[model samples]
Target: MLNPLSLVSPPALRAALRDRLTFRAKLTAAFTALFFCAGAALLIFVTVLARQGTMEQFARITMDHTGGPTAPQPTSSTSLAPVSPPGPDRAASTPGPGPAASTEPWQKAEDARLARVEVNNRLQETAVRQMVVWSAVGLAVMAVLSGAMGWWLAGRALRPVRKVILAARRMSEENLHERLQLTGPQDELRELGDTYDTMLDRLERSFTSQRRFVANASHELRTPLAAQRTSIEVGLADPLPAHLIPVREDLLITNREAEHLIAALLLLARSDRGLDETEDTDLAELTRQAADELSSLAAERTVVTTVHTTPLSVNGDPVLLKHLASNLVRNAIQYNHPQGTVTVRIDDARRLTVTNTGPRIDPTRVDSLFEPFRRLDRDRTAVHGHGLGLSIVRSIATAHGGTVTAAPVPAGGLRIEVRLPTTR
Candidate 1:
């Protein structure tokens, strides 16, 4: 035989399994089932006790009574007392029939006694049957009522849990200071809420320390890099020997790339730290500005650029939002083949999509493109970028409470889509 579990689809089975894990449902089902089973047991015990009692009463009495024209009629009493035959003097006066003739009334009396006993047994059985049926019906109704009551009680008992879940959802890494300061009786639920708040307290402190460290490190790192860049520009401004000229240019290029990397790191850190404040900013205008700035780069690569946009406003940091657009367009241009096309589109829903014709990316490996410092060539010295472009785009979008997704195009290249809410 096929396993019954196999008949259920995987999704349906998962749903059922998850439902069974619900605390409220489990509590209600357990209480109802226990009550129903116990009630049935009690009912069965009473029924059997009543039946046994009736049988015992029949066993105790003789039931050897005679029936005749002058005999007393039967009654509804449980015990039937045997009657003694008429005395010898009374029999002599009555001139009763012979012994064999007397057998008729005795036989009839025995038959009548057996018949009455059978009828009483049937009546008792019927009474017991009716009692069982009605009791069962009452038990079923009570079970339903108990289930409903249990469900409500369970919900009330679990109210604190819902509060914790809501508070956890509201308190992201950026807002770890929020706490579930639940109020009510000092029960398990209250204790749980208090524990959660304590955990958040520790988390908030840790995040504050980390943010401070990042800020200090960023300042320290940028200072030297800026000085280095200035020195290179001033010291190497004059022409040099034929061989020294190439060396000077290489030094300048290396210094500039280093500064770019440091700046990218700071931007990524700021985006991950989350927006401090938000304002209404037109995404269409930002996209135009960012893409326009990269127009020269696209021309240098001989890649055609196309932009389609509509007025779209969203609430976020303007600097970060512009960078998000700039990075996307820059990556499209930088990674494309000569004569390839880059298309940027925006809509009123605060959505932006940038499609580019480039070398085909493996569908499976496309997800890794969003990781910090991941390059398709697997080299940190790749010409186009330091591999932080997509990662920074993802961080900025996340800080704005938006989503970004990329999929490889069928013909070649990638189509990246971003979705942002219209308002904060």
Candidate 2:
């Protein structure tokens, strides 16, 4: 058995109808039904009244023809005496079967019947007209009420969407912290709100990091610029006869610092944008060439270098890749111990590892080693360039969709691994 409550309720039916019909259409249908019913009832009432009137008129005419004095009368034959004519006074006093006499009772009865019928009919007609008018009026009132309700319901249903629109309109770059206060169960709108919030969070973090990087860059450049200015001012203001050589050397050092700063800045900017162009290049051949170029630098530090050759090919800017390999080998030789062995290994998988005997770095700071201006304590004395070698390496690797990692070896050295996607 179905529950009575499962039946379509009044509100449900009304809503379904409202969805299907427009306001004007519902009003038109209602008014048309009322008018048709009223017209039909009026027609029936008029027909009944006309029929009764015609019957009454027929009865009146029959009585008038039958009750005339010229009509024949029935006679009795048993009487012997002749009938005397009616005297004027007696005839005047007696009632004959004329129109007035024959029809008196019937006319009275018919008049009464007609009067009663007219009264009842008038009452009935009045009631029917009143009912139809009232019914139409009630329907009109209901239509007005329903219109008001529908408007209210439409407004309520769109309230949440309105709120979302307002929230979205208020968002901007400066006010990215603002978010929609959506209070509902999981839905498309809620999911949209969540995604929007997540995007804003990421953007905020990126902007914050960018701002910090700019500030740090400004500070780093200002130091070298100030030193250069001081050196120039001192050289111009006082040319001491005895300290002329030292002053020139100090100026040279300041100029070198400025040049280093500029180079580091350019490298960082290029890495951020990506390599200008890419071409097919042999990684192993490039590494061997860089090792040969850096052999003199390594020999001065007494670092014994060994290079393993393999045909490791990749698609990239050859110039940048050469610079990347040189930086890695140079850092290794510059930071290694006296007479330490520096090994460069290249495999068929385009994996290159550079290991050098050097003071081990703290594991916690290994990740930060690739950051610009970061340098290990052992390389502090090695000068003439900014601490951006590993930073450039990481950047080039990223541009080529590769990665680099540094770890302390068990044999008391640093092992740097460079992994590149092999061109198959």
Candidate 3:
């Protein structure tokens, strides 16, 4: 058989013990239980005190009727007049009062005591019954109020959490710039909202950059493809020797441009995926090798090349490091004036500085030089470049956990620097 206590146990209490109760449910249950218990305890105290007071009042009333706290004066047992003793014959004739009459003298006192006790018992019972009714009413009302208050308080506490949930539900990549902008004290919830807002800010910038990059890439590719197609169409128009030679040359040039564009795109993509391998590498050696590899390109441009090196070891992907150095050197040579000097230096602090003599660069446009496909109007000609050299250098340097900075030299050139973390 189930215990009566088990039958009376609250379902919410059982759920809470099983860890299946909601926070609001637990809070309401706790409030009800607390109010009920307090009411029950108070009722019990009042009932006991009232019963005791009623009994005491009844005692005083009973005592007043029968004399004070001292015992009542003993009823006189002596008879007022003397009477002659009955003979044996008379005694036999008059039956002695049996047990009923032998204790008749104290009958009044016994009746009074019984009467007081009955009244006290009735009064105490009535008082306890009234207490029960009042207590039940009060506890029911208290439970209702406590539940309402508990729910309100719990909702207030969880408001921020609900806001966060709603904000997250509404979020998407396209709408990453939106922010919660929560306004309140700097509590944990507020801090969480701020952190989420900051993350969205970064995501918005990255997505924007990616979109712009893709659009520019498509435009760049289309330009060369359109040229190649036009060249082919014109060459096929007559199928003559004169048209064929020029067409072949135009096609080859366009194909070379397309190839270079594709290679640059692939390298950029690979760099975005980060380094594939890392090892101890000397920046000085990489710089020297890059300068040598570009010697012919430099010579063709009538640009003088000089290399200064200091052995600086760093941990990075060698191929990417080589690409970074080569790109920087190539950019210096390609953008320089004819007969200009290109200086490649690897300092003791693991910095690679490439300085070249070129046309004066606008200081405002220095930062944009690292952006892919971004070139000055003058450098957009066929013989100049695809405007990806500086961009590739920046990407490769970033992949190696390094930074690149550039500034226009006062004498009319660009001085670029790449700083890498040295291996201990």
Candidate 4:
């Protein structure tokens, strides 16, 4: 049976709703909570005091009506009860010897005062209940107003922070010169913007230095290589001595490999710097050309090649796009089994795929194939490639706002796919 707890979203378990709230929302909540607590405390204090005072006033008025704090006492002592002087008239007026006529007048007055005090208490209690209801209504209204005010204050305070975020997000290798230039007091937000600007300045300088170095290195290294290739081709000509034939062929092959390595390196660096201009290029044509260029290698490896196209096109640097296609096709062919099949295809949606029937590849380690110098275990110690092919392909694709992914095909082989934005 599935665990009920497992049905919960992973994110829900990792972060609560309150924790996921933005900084401004959290600050507003804090403000509203504080205001509510303070207001409630003040209202409760006043309600208690008012109730006590009202009750005390009711007691004082009750005492006044009763004449004194205690019942009145007789000033002089006399007979306990009035006895009529032995007269027949007194006996005739009194019906019986009952003590009803001898009752104290103050006792009746005290009972009437207690009834008035009870009525007053009921009125006071009613007033307190009404006061409590009104207090709750007032508190609720104030809470709403407080929440609105807190939200407004939070928005105002976060205005500069939002600006800083926008400025940072827009910062890229091509636009490293841009700055926040935030003008305000030397508070934390202002300090944050300033620090961000400083970091950009350093980044701008570093990128500039890196590009300069790449350019200088490219020119310096390519000049000597070109000169060497020219010397070898001219001095060694076509027909040569049998003893020197192998040496000449070796030199030419070595020179060609060096040139290829340098070209790949330059392509990687160029792609990293991003595209300066873009033009509509048909990816189908590039895919075909890549296959044709590597036809000799495939023939030597006894690999069969097939190309299919659907007229896919994208807006990007043609040279970089061509290199990306070439690298993918070359990697597939170079890492394939003898007499294997390499198929290339591009669709109208600007998706290019290359699948090869090569040696079985570990599915889990397929992703590492795109990293520089990372190769399958079968080719790990082989000197045929330095494994920069896929890395360059990825860099170029990213420069063109494209993506590349690779997966191991079941039953031994690999499949790679590249997707680029269609031309507008």
Candidate 5:
């Protein structure tokens, strides 16, 4: 017959295990259970041994009380029975009765009963010992099974985490397009993967824009540089009449274009480095100064300019701020219709708005218009600029921790607002 203890199959036992219970926990629980069981067994064994020892001592005491084979004394001397002499020939021929024959029947019966009880007690103790040994063995087997099951469960529970780790490890700049496969409900790990993918998408877009900007800037710089070189080469190759000034004009144009490109590059570099020559200046005074400086250009365009002023103090580099304000005002006047109005307003709220009557800008392209080398007019005829004027304005405003926004006026033309944080 199969032992009941060994009837538990390994696979069936393993199937009963739970997940996330680690090996150490299982070990600790098993040892604790084993320690208690061992203690209980030891206690039972000691109690049984003690009871057996006590019973043995009691049996010896009873035997001593019975005075083994010793005869009882008379209560009084007259009551004693006189000894009878045996026949002389019979005494000589037969041996006297030994002490063993003098023992009482009850004494022997009690001794035999005690021996039988002792044998039965020994059998009971043997059965108890066997039970304790088997129980302990069963507990040890359970501990081993539990430890194996716990380790397997721990591994299974950590499987998802491991997959996430592997995915993260495989991620690189070259392979940022690769994404984690989220197959389950939106748990924390899945949420984390989603966020990571979102960030990577944004980074990829930024990188694409940066690459295009670099390519466009290089093309813009190359045009003027090539023109300057050609002008210099042509002027040196031939001596022209003094009044035939087309060459001089061409050289002048080339020089201006080169200077504009260099200046734009410098501004972009400085903006990137966070280099600003800052100081506290009156914005109203700055506006007046910019209007005066641009008066000649405005007159040439036949654009009437009006300046409304309020004292607004701000902390920033005066030259850069003037450049920013001048660019906006110039862009307005340059793009305005002949005999149109260009208005500059400075308010106590530290707001500067330059509004001009001009051709309306396409709403779709408004956001990209402020990017470097992005011209609103692709033909470059309606307006003359390095396409970096508004970009520089944005850069300088950002350096001063301000913002510049351009919006079309409800009535007509464009309204460019520069908002700065005021200083008391």
Candidate 6:
């Protein structure tokens, strides 16, 4: 014999399986099941109650009387006493056959039995019909209501997910700054949105940094190229020997500037790549070397340079770290005034400080000191330093798991500090 359940058509079976997996379908199915079960239970209870009532009524009828019916009681004083059989034999004067045996009593008993059976059958039929019709109607109504409610509830629960999807679709690199910012009581969806927003925040910062770096690089390169082109064009225009020597000198100066700019750009790129090699090196030693390297430049500019060292070791790329130290010292010496002091200090706490007596800087411009190609008023107008000095310092320090901070000195110039984790 075939299993009745397995006899379902293929299309119907597939649809049922598909519906079972979906949230909406599952929710609706759950509601329908509950409604159906409840309705069936109520119907069964009602049917049982009705059946019990009918049985009780039949039982009452069956047990109510003594046998079928009691013998008829005397109706009045006239029939209170028996007839006395009408004087045994009233002779020939009495009716001939004494009224053939009466059959009325037997007929009445038969009629009563048939009437009871008919009433019972009619009552049962009525109850069964009513139950079938009303239960079906109630079930149909409840199924519809349950399905609608389930659909509505499911939509409400998924509303936040829809918002997240829409927001994600509208996202791009240019609009990474946009946040879901979903507001509600803490739940899984809210947590997800908050996490997504945090990720976007990180992406936006990274993009902004990259864009600024590229723009600064382009502007720095273009300025030198433009100057070089102008110098060459002017030099070629004046062919005289006297003018030619001066023009050649101008070309050399422009070429040197371009060279310095290119070197700075390359150093900046390397620093941005982060440390690819690590070694235990004394920061104090690097600081001393950097100071010695810039000592001549300092002297030529009438700036006195000094280095104070205490052995403090850190793990980082030696080249990048050396570059970091050199940039700081160079900036100090290049930006200092005549008779000014440049102090490079390496403390035992893994901190490097470079202080210089240069033109007093505006406090507001201190933060911008570490931005690529950004310089103070004097450095901006001066023909010398390209402004990647502090930026390179900051990048290298960060790559080595360190922090750099700078403050404008009250007595003129800048005080910069770099703190690195000590090698263990």
- RMSD of each candidate relative to the true structure: 6.5, 19.5, 18.7, 5.3, 18.8, 17.9
Runs in model 4 deviating more than 4 A are 1-15, 73-104, 167-171, 229-252, 359-368, 376-383, 410-413
Scored by TM-score, the top model is 1
TM-score of each: 0.83, 0.47, 0.48, 0.80, 0.46, 0.49
lDDT of each: 0.85, 0.73, 0.78, 0.84, 0.72, 0.79
TM-score of 3: 0.48
**Considering only N, C-alpha and C atoms within 3 Å, which residue pairs clash in candidate 6?**
none
Candidate 2, 303-411: lDDT as tens digits: 9999997988888878778878898999888777898989999976668899999776777777777888887665544645677888889887877778899997776
What C-alpha root-mean-square deviation, in Å, does candidate 2 show against the real structure? 19.5
Residue-level lDDT of model 4, residues 1-424, one tens digit each, is: 9998788798886677768899998988899899889989988998899999999998888877677546456445433666558677776676654445444566677778878988998999999999999988999899889999999999999998999888877666657889888897999989988998899999989998887786668767888999999999899887888998899889988888877777777887899788988999888998899899999999998999999888976899999999998998888888887889999988665689999996678888989988877887965435477688999999888778778999888877889999888753
Model 3 Cα displacement at 184 (Å)? 15
- Among all windows of 10 consecutive residues in model 4, the one with the lowest summed lDDT is 70-79
lDDT of 3: 0.78
Worst 10 residues of 6 by lDDT: 65-74
TM-score of 5: 0.46
lDDT of 6 by residue, 279-341 (tens): 898777887887888888988999998888898888878888888999999988888888999
- The residue pairs found clashing in candidate 5 are none
Clashes of each: 0, 0, 0, 0, 0, 0
lDDT tens readout by residue for model 1, 1-424: 9999999999999899877788888889898999999999999999999999977665444253433224444455514645558899755765447666757765777677777778778878898899999999999999999999999998888899988988888877767877778899999999999999999999888887776776678778888988987887788777666877788888888888877887888898899899999999998899999988999998998999999999888899999999999999999888888899999998655579999997777889888899988876532234547789999999899888889999988888889999988888
Global Cα lDDT for candidate 6: 0.79
